[model samples]
Target: MLTIRRHLVDAIVEHARKDHPDEACGVIAGPAGSDRPERFVPMLNAARSPTFYEFDSMDLLHLYREMDDNDEEPVVIYHSHTATEAYPSRTDIGLANEPGAHYVLVSTRDEDTHEFRSFRIVDGEVTEEEVQVIDGE
Candidate 1:
């Protein structure tokens, strides 16, 4: 299971709504502990497609270096489901590069509300997990 912050979830929902008719992608960075394996630090992705998403390699690389410098790690990769359910697509499953990282999906198909879900994709198989959002500090 993944424990995301309430503020982060709200941000993602807003992003999804703001990017209506297109997909929005982002990165989540935080410490990983036994009790809270994944925490979220929402990031914006300038490069996104309506039907797909691709992290900007340059931006990602820069953020990676920055995170490393800050002694933080990206624990989750997130994207929005603009017109679909909060589930992984075949493309998303196939593009799972971080087996250890949580894959978060925020569904924005109804009422512009956010329904966050978590998953882990390994070897083309998707295993759904529970997501608990806690109030932010």
Candidate 2:
């Protein structure tokens, strides 16, 4: 299960909505080994495609460096799907290198509804997980 704050969820949804038609990608970092998500780091989708998302290589490197300096790790890695369900594609499972991170997908396929889902992708295997959103601070 992935337990996260409500405000964080709202923030992610907003980012996704803002980037509709092009996938929005980002990470939520937290203290190493804490399994908590506290910092929202919105990222550029290098691909800028409605069906795909790729973090800019330079930005990813910088983010890793900063997270290291701050003693943080990416607890949640997220992306948006403009016209699809909130589920991982085959490419997503193949590209998931962080076995410990929660992979979140937000779908903005409908104007009236948003689909938010979380998964764990390890070694080409995808496992859907429970998400518990807590009240905002």
TM-score of 2: 0.98
The clash numbers for all candidates, in the given order, read: 0, 0
Number of the top lDDT candidate? 2
Candidate 2 residues lying further than 4 Å off, grouped into runs, are: none
23-74 in candidate 2: lDDT tens per residue?
Answer: 9999999999999999999999999899899999999999999999999999
- The residue pairs found clashing in candidate 2 are none
TM-score of 1: 0.85
The sequence of per-residue lDDT tens digits that candidate 1 reaches over residues 1-137 is 88777777777777777876677887767654333333344455555566687777777888788767766666778888777898999999988987877888888778636678889888888999988889855
